[model samples]
Target: MVTPGSPRGIDVKIGIVDYEAGNLKSVETALRYLHADYFISSDPSVLKKGDKIIFPGVGEARSAMRILSERGLDQFIKDFFKSGKPLLGICLGCQIVLKSSEENSTYCLGLVPGVSREFSVEMGLKIPHMGWNQVSIKGSHYIFRDIPDNGSFYFVHSFYPELDKSSQVIGSTEYGIEFSSAFSVDNLVALQFHPEKSGPFGLKILDNFIKGAD
Candidate 1:
């Protein structure tokens, strides 16, 4: 098994699953900028060999789930989480980790106990909450280790996860209402914001994740 101090000869393989729906390129660029050893693949075999898995998405939940099902990625993702390795989900990717999503009434990976619903546009709010927003971090997590408190991160999403208090919510943000911004529980972790586009603070979070991975 891999550990923090595993042999230096062993290179950690980070697998970013390509679901053909999201900003895959940008996520790859971010990892490249960090000089992280990673690979992009849709193959379950490659994913099974991943030291850590990052699921990034940006599109309709139903359509994304359809693609996942068609490619047999649904079961692969479930098994990836079951391996107890680090898993980071960004944006719509984060929504799918829960039990279900109101966006298209789709069932999700059910790794986390929660449901995602669309933000009320009737509140005179933007349909997709875009641009930079500050994240109010709650508990101490390794992911945010060296990041400053109340740091701003880029976000673009119409739906957000409604989490149970026991879910170990580590951060939150305000956009018409307070919502879960990030969470972690044992080996499973997720972020509602795009760390790849969140600038320096975001990179620090990624660094923390990479460093903490076994």
Candidate 2:
């Protein structure tokens, strides 16, 4: 469990995984605002040097997976997760951790046991669920300890993670349907929304992860 602490980015080195995915700079921008020490890299070796890892991604799953494979980051992420350190997933980072994505039937890292599914068109919502939405906390997870129960966060995705174990879910949100917006397993904390783009509350989430969640 995470305890109360000041921002520890000076002590904690964060690694933001880069695989040519979008939104890398925005995440970096957030870390910078928090005065966190971080580096963006595609090299597995450099990423392994980080005390904490932030996997943020955007764009199609197929191409993302392809880039990860080409750079051998696919196996590196799997290995890193087993190390049991603090790892945060944002947006595509949340979806790609699953076994596969419905987007082109692309196989993912399978770090979490589930699949990413597209929102139903019949729901009459936009294909990409953009803009702000409220995320309801499921339990007392440290990642959301400082965040309000139903805080609004920025989101820009059509696919959502449907985990096999509901016990792992830490947060949920409603689009056309209720879905897993955030989940945690061991040291991994993942959110389908873009916390970096969500303003103060979002920065708090990052601060919580960086300073407290170990």
Candidate 3:
């Protein structure tokens, strides 16, 4: 398995999206530790130059979208998707890419045909669902390369995206009901968990993502 260093596959101009989203520091630290070159940019033009974009967000859905809109990052992301460049969205980043979110009845980027909803407290499930959980890998996705099918990762969120059977659910974890833990379709992928905070296994996931960016 390849370690988190120079991709050894492709040299990616990595750009991390800065939309006032929390957990950016952890993500940036991981990349730095991985020896990957990256920059945190709020400017669309600077981001457009990136070969791969990382949208690791952790904030309220409505306000996050509003920030994206106000900064004109909404269209920038859309155009980036259309450009077929690789994008990795995490946590709130994952939610904002979906069709809609129950959090404040917010409409999202609609890249993934799914909805982000809160885990019901009535189901005896804890709100936020914070903690480490095992994720069952669906297929032989590049993102899962060097990572076990049932690896544990750190998660800290109340809501998750509900994907259809045919949805690009590369990794799944059962909280109360089965929910998508990670989604990968073509060049775009999103994760509900925080790989940066997930230790060595998380590093492997990020390494795989970088290698697969080509």
User: Which ranges of candidate 3 are over 4 A from the true structure?
Assistant: 1-7
lDDT of 1 by residue, 13-56 (tens): 89999999568889888887777888998988878888999999
Candidate 1 vs candidate 2: the TM-score winner is 2
In angstroms, how far off is 2's CA in candidate 3?
Answer: 7.2
Give the higher-TM-score candidate: 1 or 3: 3
Could you tell me which residue pairs clash in candidate 2? none
What stretches of model 1 exceed 4 Å from their correct place? 1-10
- The superposed Cα distance between candidate 1 and the true structure at residue 198, in angstroms, equals 0.9
- TM-scores of the candidates are 0.92, 0.95, 0.95
Report the C-alpha lDDT of model 2 over 1-214, residue by residue, as the tens digit. 2223443644889999998879999999888878788899999999999999999998999999999999999998999999998889899999999999999999999999999999998988888999999999998999896788999999999899999999999999999888999999998999999988998888889888878654
RMSD, every candidate, angstroms: 4.2, 2.9, 1.6
lDDT against true structure, model 3: 0.87
Residue 114 displacement in candidate 2 (angstroms):
0.6
lDDT of 2: 0.90
Give lDDT per model, in order. Answer: 0.84, 0.90, 0.87
